[model samples]
Target: MEQKREISDEQRFCEMRATVEDCNRFACALFQQLSAQNSGNLFFSPASISTALAMTLAGARGETAQEMHNALQLTQEGAQLHAAFQRLLSETRTGGVELDVANQLWGKTGYHFLAPFLETIRDCYDGGLQLVDFQEEPAAAADQINEWVSRATHGKITELVSPMSFHELTRLILVNAIYFKGAWEDEFEPERTRDQTFYLAGDQQTSVPMMHQTGSFGYFENETLQVLELPYRKRNYVPQFVENEDGSVGLMHTEVPGGGGDFSMCILLPRERDGLNDLEKEIDSATLQTWLTMRHQEVIVSLPRFQLELEYELNTPLESLGMERAFQPSSADFYGMTDNPEGLYIDAVLHKTFVDINERGTEAAAVTGVVWAAGCAQEPEPPKVFCADHPFLFLIRDRQTGWIYFMGRFNQPEHQAD
Candidate 1:
C-alpha cells in the first residue's frame, strides 16, 4: 500500500503567510491613499509601516492576540513589525499627543494585546497625534484637526478635514499627528550653497538658495524615464532618482539591495505657492496610480543636493484614496471588546507628515491616529495643481508596500550663485 502523505507545518505556515500577505496588501492600499492625498513624502523600512497600520487596526477592532500576531506575521527574530509601530507611537508622543487618546480609540474592544505592539514600538517615532471630540461641540474636532493640518503642512495644506453630524451612535473625534526633521544626504559645503535663479513658468524666475555638488553617480535612462542616482553623505543612505515622463515629473526611489529601507516617489505640479487648490485638481488617487504604471522608454536625469522642507496633511486625500470604511462609524466594526455595540466606532482618521531635505539626505517623520465616536455625520471644493514648474523633487515608491522610500529632483541648477 502507498504510504500516506501528511501536510507539513511549514505548508500550514505558507497558508498563514498568504493570509498575512493579503492583509499586508490591504494595509498598504490604505497607506498609499494617505500618501497620495497629502502630496507629501513618506518613508518606511521594509514592512514596518504596513505592519504598524495592520496591528493598530486589528487592536482597535478587538482582535485576539493570536489573531494580531497572525495578521502581522510577527516572527521572534525580526522586530520589523514591532519596530514600525513603536516608531509611529514614539513620533506621535514626540509631538505632544497623549497616549491615552490612542488607547481610548484602540482599547474600545478590550483588545489590549494590540496595545503592547504599539507601546513597544513607540520609541522609534518622532511626531504627535491629537484627539478632538466633536460631540461636545459641533465641528470642534474638525476645527482642531484643521489647525493641526495647517501647521503640519507649513500652510501648504488647509482645511482638509471638517466635522459634521452623522447617524452612528458613537460620538466622533479627530486624531491628528505631525513631524519634521532635516538631514544631509551629501552635506553641501557651506560655501557651495548660494542664491541662484529658480526658473518659474515662462520668463519668471526667483532667486533661491541652491546647493551644488559633482560626483560620479549610478546613472541610467530609458525611453520613458530618466534615472540619476545621488548618494547621501551617509553611505548607509541609498541614492535617489528623478524621472520626467511626458508632462508629469516625479521623484523615484528604488528598492535598496537586500530589500531594506524606505521607498517613495513624489510628484509636484506647480501651483501658486500660496495655496494647494491648483495642485489638488490636477492629481488624485487614480492619477497617481496611473503614473506608476506608465511606461518610460528612454530618459536622462541629474539632480544636485538642495534644501527643502515640506509639510502636508493626509485626511482629505486619504478619503479620496479609498479608505472610506475606516472613517465611517456605521461601516467600521470595533464591537468585540465592550457590550456597548455603538460605543467606539472610528469617527475620523487624521495624519500629518513633515520632512526636510538637505545634504544629509532625507530625515522625516509622520503620525496618524483614529478617533472614535458615540455616533455621527459628514465636503466640497474645486481642486488645483501646483505646476511644479521650478526645480522640484519627487520619489517613486512601492505603491503596495511603501518599502523603499527614496528622493530626487527633476531640475538641476547650472551653478550655485552667491
Candidate 2:
C-alpha cells in the first residue's frame, strides 16, 4: 500500500488562495446572471453553492467535468480543489465568529458509488456519506437531510430538500449548509433608528426603519458610488503547535490572532437614488476588487433594517452559465462517481437563503442541495455619506481570504422587526 504524501504548508496555502479567488470570481458571474433574471431582491451564498457543487465535481468526468470547471472558475486541478476546500473550511472554523458550515451526502441504500468519490468528499469536505432509504422512503430521506441541515445551521435553515425533488430513481443528494451570526464592532443604536423613505425603481418609495450611526468606519467613494465596511466583532484565538505522528511540529492555523479572518459586511451604495441598475451593469470581479480598496475614516451612515428569504431552482441559471450538459440526462457524464451503465445526471439544484441585517449586525443562513438523481471593503476619507436610501448590493466576506459567504442586492426593504 502506498502511503499518502503529506501536503506542505506552502502548497496548502497556495491551493486555498486559488480556491478563494476562483469562488470570488464565480460569485460575481453568478450574481450578474441572477440580477438579470430577477428584478427584485436577490440573495445567495456563492461559497455554500460552490462547496456543494465542488463535491459533485469530484464525481464528474469528461464534458461534465470540463464544463463545471469552467463555470466554477476553478484554477486548481480537480483533486486539488477538494483539498483547498478542506483548508479553507478549516480556516473558517478558526475565525472568532458564530459561523458553522456543514456538508453531507445522502445515498440510496444499496446504491453503489465509487469508493474514491465518497472518500474524497469525506476527507476534503467533511461530508460523510450516509446510506438512506431513498428508494423506499424518499420523503424520509429528504426529512433526514433537512433535519441534519437544520441542526447544523442551529435551526436557521429547516427544509433544504423537498420530497418532490427526489424520487425512487434518486441515487444521490449532496448538501451544504452555512450559518453565520456576527455582532457589529460598532453597533447602531436603536434610539437613532427612524422610519425613512426608501426610493424604489420607477419613481416609487416606501417607508422603512433605517438605522443611523456616525463613527469611524472603512469608507471610500467615487463619482458613481460609495463603499462602506461594517466590521463584525472578532473572537480571539491562540495558535498552538502540535507534534505530528512523525514527530515533526506543524503550525496550527485554527484562528489567526489578527489576520484576514475578521468578518465584515461590505455595502456598495449607488450615488443616485436609482443607480443600482447601472452599478450592477458595470460591476464585475475586477471592478469589485478595485472598490474594496477603501480607507478608514469617520463617516455618517444610514442603512435600512431588512430581512429577506429567497429560494431558487438553479438548474436554468447554472445551465445558462455553461454547464448545460450536466442537466441533460442522456448526455451527462458522471462516470467518476458510479460505474453503473445508467450514468447519474443532475436532476435539480435547489438553493435557499435567509438574511437579516439590523442595528445589531447580520445573521445569515444558506443551504444548497445538489440532487444527483442524475448529477449536479475599504474606505475612509472624510465623512462620506453612505445612505443606502435606495437599491444597493451587499456581501458578507472574509477579509483575508476574499471569500464571499453571502452576496445579494437589497432593493425594496421588507416590513420586519429589528
Candidate 3:
C-alpha cells in the first residue's frame, strides 16, 4: 500500500497568517506615513505595494535586502517568504469572491535581467515578463505599462505611469495589480438610500448620498470607535487543503466541504466625527485582530455611496518607513535584476487605487508599479445607526487568510484632482 501523507490545516493556516500579519504591520506603518502628509480622503493599497516590493526584494542583495526585511517586517527568508506568498495567492483565489492578482516585469531592451531572479519570481509568484525599450522610447514604454495596469485592474486604475515619471535611464519596471469585486452577504436596499448630512473635519458638513440598512452584523464597540463587519457573499467555493505540484502546502477549490468568509468589509467609525485621526493612531496589529472578534447584533448602518480614484508618488513615504536603501542610486543593490550592476535602481514608486461602493455591493482595484521602474461595511440597530458621517477607517479583507486587500479613511469626499 502507498504511504499516506498530508499537510495539516493548521500548518497551511499558520503560513498564510504569517504572511498576512506581515502585510498588516506594513499597512499600519505605511498608513501612518501616508496619513502624516495629507488630511483629505486618503487611500492606497498596502498589499499591492508590498507585492511590488516583494518582486524587488527577490532581486535585492546584501544590506538592501536586510533593509527591506526590516522595513517590511518580513520574518521569512527568500525562498520561504516566496513560498508563503505563493500559498497565500493560491488560497485567496479559491474563495467565493473575485480576487485577481497579476505581476509583470518590464525590462528595457539591451539590459539583461539575471536568470535566477527571473526564475525565482516566475516559479514562486508566477510573474510574467515583458521587454520594453524604455531607453529608446520612454513615452511608448510608459504607455505600454499603463495599458497593462489598466487592463489588469479592469480599467479602475486606468493608468499607472505618466511620461514625466519614466525616463531613458529606466532599466526595468515591476508591476503588481489587484482587482476585487464582492457583494455584501446582506446588502443594502437602494430605495432606502437618501441624501444626508455628513459632518466633516473642522465642523464642516456636506450633503452626501448615504445608504441605510438594518441587519444582524458582526459588531464591536469601545470608548473611541464602533466596528462593523459586512461579510461578502460566499456560496460557491469550498476549500480543500491540498498539496501543490512542488508538494508545497496550499489549497484547492472543490465541492463544498466547509468554507465561509470569502471576502468581507470591516468599517471603523470614530465615536467623535473628527476623532478619526486619534482612532487611527490607536491601530496596531492587535487592535485590528481584536476588533474582528465582533459579535452579531442588530445595528442600523449608514454609509455613504461614494466613488474615489487616487494617485500617489510613494518615494518619500517609503523612505520614511526605513526603505531608503532601495531608492538611492549609488547604494541600491538590485544587481540580481540585471547584468549591468549599476544599471538599475528604483526610479520611483507609483500607485493608483479606485473604489465604488453602492447599494448593491463593492468594486475596487489597485495597481502598484515600482518604476524600475520601480517600486467595508455594515451594521444595524436602534437598532445602532452606525453612521459613517465623519472621518473613518475601513478595511476589506479575506477573513480566512487575514489578507487586507483595501484600507483607507474617508474624512471628506473630494473629486479627483487629476
Candidate 4:
C-alpha cells in the first residue's frame, strides 16, 4: 500500500509567507502610486493580479522573463516555481471557505501558440486556452471574455475588459478570477448593528451601520494602531468528500478556532483619527510578517457593515516595479508564447474587487484581466473597543497559508475614497 502525505501547517505558512512578501511588495508600490494620484477607496487583490501575471509569465522569455521575475520578486524558476504555486493554491482551499480560482487564455483566432507555453500553464495553473477572434471582431470577443469573468466571479466583476480595449492589436489575453465567500465563525448579531458616524479624514463624517460583537478573539496593538482577527467558520464533521486542495475536511469543523478556520479578516485601525496615510507608509512585506505572529487576546470588537467595489489600470505601478519590458510593444519578448513576437505585447492589465461584510459573514470576489496591455491589512488592541469609526485597512487572509485575497480600506459607507 502507498501512503499519501499531507502538507504541514508550518510548511504552508512558510510558502505563503514568501508569496506574501512578493504580493505585498507589489501592493505597496501600487498603493503608493494610487495615493500619489489622489485615488480613493483602495481595494484589489494582489494575489489575483500576481496569479494572472504568473500565468502570463509562463510564456515570457529572455529579458521580459527576467524583468518580470525581478519585479514580482519570484526568484524560483522552472519546476520549483510551478510546483510551489500548485501546492500553495491547493493547500489554501480549506473546507470551510468557498474559494474558487480559475484561469483562461484567450488568443486571437489563427494564432499559433507554442505547445510548451500552453502545457506549462495547464499543468501549473490549470489554465485552459480558449480561442477567440479578436482580430476580426473585437467587440464580440470582449463580450465573451467579460461574460466568462461575470460567471466565474458570480457577477461581482462584470466588465474586466472594455469593448474598446480589444482590436486588431490584441494577440493573447490571460485572465484569473478568484471568488471567496466565508461566514464568520463567531456570528454577529443583526439586532446589535445600528447606524453610527464614521470619521473620515479631517472634518468629514458619514453615517454607517456598525455591528458590535464581544468575544475572545486574536488581538494585537501597538502605539500607532491596533489589529483584530475575525475568524470564519470551519467544517464541523466529516462527510462524504474527497481530498481537497486546501485541506478543508468538509463538515469536519462545525465552528471556528477549534476544528480549523483557514480564513480570517484582519483589521488595522490607526490610533489617531487621521493616521491612515502614515499607517500605510509603515506597512511592507516585513512589517506584515511581524504582525502575523502577534498574540491573541480577549476583547470587544465593533465593526461597521460595508461594501466596497474597485477597478484600476495597473500598467504604471507594475511598470514602476521594474517590469517595464513586458509592457513595451517593441522591447517586450514573449518568444516562448509563439515563434514570432510581432505586435505581441501587454496591452493592459485590469483588476476588479468587490467585498460585502454584514452581520453574518463576508462575501468577496476579485477578477484580474491581463489584456496584454499590462501591468501589474492590520491589527488592534484595547480590552479593544475597536471602534473603527475612522479610515482603516483590512484584508481577507488565509490563516492556513498566509495568502491575502481581498485588501481594502473603509473610509466611507458609500462611494467615497480612503
By lDDT, the best candidate is 2
For TM-score, the strongest prediction is 2
Query: What are the runs in model 4 whose C-alpha is more than 4 Å off?
Result: 1-17, 238-260, 341-343, 373-382, 415-418
Model-by-model lDDT, in order? 0.38, 0.85, 0.80, 0.78
Model 2 lDDT tens row, 89-125: 9876435568888898888788788988888888888
TM-score of each candidate structure, all chains considered together: 0.46, 0.91, 0.88, 0.87
Ranking by TM-score: 2, 3, 4, 1
> How do the residues 50-94 of candidate 1 rate in per-residue lDDT, one tens digit apiece?
333443443344333333344333442123433334333332211
Rank by lDDT, descending?
Answer: 2, 3, 4, 1
lDDT of 2: 0.85
Q: Each candidate's root-mean-square deviation in Å?
A: 15.5, 6.8, 8.4, 6.8
Candidate 4 lDDT, tens digit per residue, 8-64?
877656655676566667665666666665446777887888788877777787899
Question: Which of the two, 1 or 2, has more TM-score?
Answer: 2
